[model samples]
Target chain A: MNLIAFAILALLAATAVTVARMRDLWAAIMFTGIYSFLSASWMLILDAPDVAFTEAAVGAGIATVLMLSTLALTGKEERATTRSPLIPLLVVTVTGGALIYGTLDMPHFGDPSDPIHLYPNPSFVEKSQEDMHGLPNVVTAILASYRGYDTLGETTVVLTAGIAVILILRRDESHPEQQESP
Target chain B: MSIEQVVGLYNYWIVVFLMMTGFYIVIARTNLIKSIIGLNIFQTSVFLLYITMGRINGGTAPIIPAVVADAHAHAHPADAHATDGPAGHSLHETADELIYSNPLPSVLMLTAIVVGIATTALALALIVRIREEYGTVEEDEILELDRYS
Candidate 1:
């Protein structure tokens, strides 16, 4: 299990780096899809099957399609940047270092005694069984029932985004010339 | 660090590295679409971090077994007398036997993954509009155009 986790993480890191470095926009988008798929697999290994399903569907599937369509509408190759990369490298290094430092205090991987598993009374797993009356999938039970309002809000956010996209991308039939030029 | 310590913490370290790679792409690159991709990379890494935290050493996914859940469903209707019944006893035993990974993070990330895709779609729409208006998607070119005009 540890070896599988390590290998998947290494693959994820590799794909991320490749996405970062590739100048071809199409290849980069493809690599981003690969990265999402790998992460979804890793989430499965972490016992998050529902999250994995969502990530695979939305991240690897929908997001990639959206990006490819955007690429079709825009340039295919990234233009060479004239600026030096030193400052950005420095900033990322410092931020990554701080994040690594923060991880030192985190619980070891898969430690059952971690505070999250113990806190807030009976834990979500047990509480969910009681409240949901033996729902087979606890994650879905919590999302659709216990945290129903949050899911409603998420739907609203997605609705707003869809509306926003329509408004932004809609061609004005009254100003065909404007659409033609700019 | 010792091998155990390294093994314990390596997942987090790699996640951080993946995040930084995305951050670097966002800040260092000038392409707007590429920035969106970078944003996605960053978001997925955070999701990985949360899911990793929720894992238990021997836990399965947080779905109860169908037989146990069916027993639970049936046992609930006869609650007054079910306490002494075999169905109720088996339900208790099954709960004790199963170790499930934390479900809270999975719940949260399910929402986040949807939101992330929505954000990506919106951002890509904006990028397409930008391309239509400015004739380029490079950030520097857009800035230069703004500066001159």
Candidate 2:
């Protein structure tokens, strides 16, 4: 299991690097899809199949399509920039180093004694069984029932994003000539 | 570090590396669309981090098996001895034996994944509009055009 996890992480890292370096927007978007698919596989390894399903559907599927359509409307190749990369490189290195340091005290991967497994009084798994009356999927019970308001808020966010997209992209029919490319 | 320590912590280190790569792309790259791609990468790495934290060594997915759930449902109304037959007793035993990975993170990440996609879609729409108005998606050129105007 560790070996498989390592391999997937390696592939994920490779894809991220490739996406960062690629000049062609289309190729970069394709590589991003591959990265998302690999992330879904890793989530499955971590025992989060619900999250894996969502990541595969939303991340790899919808996001990739959106990016490709955006690419079609924009330039295919990124123009070469004269700006120096040293500052951004330095900033990222510092932030990453701090995050790695923060992980030192984190529980070992998959340690059952971790606080997340034993917290909030009965934990979500046991509580869901009681509150949800033997619901087969604890994650769904938590999302749709126990945490209903949170889900409702997320739905509202999605709705707002859709409306914002429509407002931004919809052509003005009253002035047809204004719709022409400048 | 020892092998065990290295094994325990390497996952987090790699995730951080992936995140930094994305951050570098977002900050250093000139293209607006590439920045959005970088943002997606950054978001995904954070999702992986949360899911990684929720794993249990021997745990299965957080979904209860159908037979076990059926046994639970049956056992709820009456005492196990009164409600369960021989097969149901075994299913009850199996349910007691099962260990599930943390469902809270899975629940949170599910919502996050949907929100991330929505954010991506909105950003892409903005990028398309920016392209239509400015005739280029490169950040530096857009700023130069603004400066001259």
Candidate 3:
């Protein structure tokens, strides 16, 4: 099990590096899809089946398609960037070092006595076990019932985004000069 | 560090590396679509981080025993008393067998994933419009055109 996890992590790292270096937008898009697939598999190995499903469907499926459609409208290969990468590289290094430092204080992987599981999670589980709501999938129960308002807000965001996209794209089609989009 | 601590911390380190890779791509890439890809990568790394945190060693998926399922299967419409006793007892019994994974992070990620796709779609749509007006999606190129005109 540990070996499988390690292999997946290694593969994920390799793919991210490849995606970063690849200049062909389409190839990078494909690699990003592969990256999502690998991450979804890792999510399953981590016992998060719901998140795995979402990652597969949304990340690999929908996000890839959206990116492809955008690619059809844009240049296939990126023009060489003129800006020196030194500044961004330095920024990433410092930010990543800070994040790693923060993780040093976090609960170790799968530590049973972690305070997260000690308090809030168990309370949520207890709520799931309540007689009024005997939900089998605790994730679904929390998403739909306990945190229904938050999910509702997310849905509203989705709705707003869809409207904004339609409004933006629809204006182009109506333009006399812009007859069709490739 | 000991082997145990390394094993515990390695997952987090991998997550941070992926996050930085995505962040660098967004910062360095000039193409709008590539930046969006970088944004997707950044969001995905976050999802992975959450799911990784929720996993418990030897824990199964977070699915509780279905009390209603058991009740319906055993109750013959006349065994109300027998069903009642088991239904109440089953809930308590679940705690004994509850070696299930944490569900909170998974739930949160579900909504995040939906929002991510929606935002990606919107970004792509705007990119398409930009291509129509500016004749390019390269940020520097578009800005250059804007400067001249």
Winning model by DockQ: 1
lDDT of 1 by residue, A1-182 (tens): 87897798889999999998899999999999999999999999999999998999889999999999888889799998889999999999999999998988888888777776655432455546667766689899989998999999999999999999999999889977875652
Q: Per-residue CA lDDT of candidate 3, range B86-143, in tens?
A: 2223222334455777788899999999998998898899899899888988999889
Residues A1-182, candidate 3, lDDT per residue (tens digit)?
87898899999999998999889999999999999999999999998998898899889998888888788777688888889999999999999999999988889988666655555526446445453345678788889888999999999999999999989988544576646533
Model 2 CA deviation exceeding 4 Å by range: A176-182, B74-95
Q: Quantify all predictions' global Cα lDDT against the true fold.
A: 0.86, 0.84, 0.82
What's the residue-level lDDT of B147 in candidate 2? 92
Which DockQ value does candidate 1 get?
0.51
Give me the displacement of residue A14 in model 2, in angstroms.
Answer: 1.0
Question: Candidate 2 residues A14-95, lDDT tens each?
Answer: 9999998898888999999999999999999999998998899889998988888888788698888788989999999999
Model 3: runs farther than 4 Å from truth?
A121-123, A126-134, A172-182, B65-94
Interface RMSDs of the predictions, in order, are: 4.5, 5.3, 4.9
| Each candidate's DockQ | 0.51, 0.48, 0.46
Q: What tens digits encode model 2's per-residue C-alpha lDDT throughout B1-149?
A: 67987878877888899999999999999899889999999999999989988887888898888877776766665443343233212211235788788788898999999998888889889889888888999898899999998
Output the lDDT of residue B23, model 3.
Answer: 100
TM-score of the A chain in model 2: 0.92
What DockQ does candidate 2 have relative to the true complex? Answer: 0.48
Deviating ranges (above 4 Å) for candidate 1: A177-182, B70-94
Docking class of 3: acceptable
> Which of the predicted structures, 1 or 3, would earn the higher DockQ when compared with the native?
1
**Which number leads on lDDT?**
1
